[model samples]
Target: MNKPCFLLLCLVANGLFPVYAITPGQTEKENPMTINMSINQQTYEISLSDTAAAKAFVEQLPLTLNMEELNGNEKFADLAHSLPTRQSRPGALHAGDLMLYGHQTLVLFYETFQTSYSYTPIGKVIAPEGLKKAVGDKNIAVHFYRD
Candidate 1:
């Protein structure tokens, strides 16, 4: 019995044997809807309620959304130049917190219902212009917040 127990301990210590399999509930699971972007060496993580919301946000972005370069760049003129034409729908518009990570910027937009939201990256100089161009001159009632 002593010999058998010693062998088992040795195997476990060397990672040659498993003491027991990890049960599903014992481990933390990854969140599927989290979006992480590194702009200019700074990292930003955005967590959403579900994958659908995340997908919707991504779909609204331009064809090329490269997080790494965005983080490093100082002026977003190039990124802004790449922005797709904005689509308009009937709802209130709310602007969330504007985050600056190095030279990259994040602008969050929320519609009236609050069920959906989207974010876009902008370089310092182009951020305000890009937002104004995206939002247009339409008047829509909306609740707003920023941090």
Candidate 2:
């Protein structure tokens, strides 16, 4: 590869320059964002959805809290402030689906399950298969930050 081309590729690979990253069904206008989640002293990268709610969540970055175990399938923590919500019903919960319950609680789904709740979708996890094991059936301190 040429010198300039190699440098450009390096930037994109490091997430500093996203030239044409259209995330699956997302439009070309949707820019990708990343978040970091820490549990058991380990940090995992999470890919966030491009939305107003997700943007708000990002603005509240570097938040730390103890997420409580829920229903054997998810972990949740209450946010100090309310996040703007886009009311929508979830058909099924999937691993790594970050969400907001009501306006104050943040939920991270780790197992698939049917649900009858409407939540503000925030983001999703995109790598490393050990997330489910990290968030087991116990309360854990989660450190969230924009990555």
Q: State the TM-score for model 1.
A: 0.23
Provide the RMSD of all predictions against the true structure, rounded to 1 decimal. Answer: 13.9, 10.7
**Considering summed lDDT, which 10 consecutive residues are worst modelled in model 2?**
22-31
Best by lDDT: 2
- Which residue pairs in model 2 clash with each other? none
Q: What is the lDDT of residue 54 in candidate 2?
A: 84
TM-score of each: 0.23, 0.77
lDDT of 2 by residue, 3-52 (tens): 99999898888797556755664752464778898889888888777678
The CA lDDT at 88 in model 2 is 85
lDDT of model number 2: 0.85
lDDT of 1 at 55: 40
Top TM-score hit: 2
Task: Identify the runs in model 1 with alpha carbons over 4 angstroms from their true place.
Answer: 1-32, 51-53, 59-106, 109-147
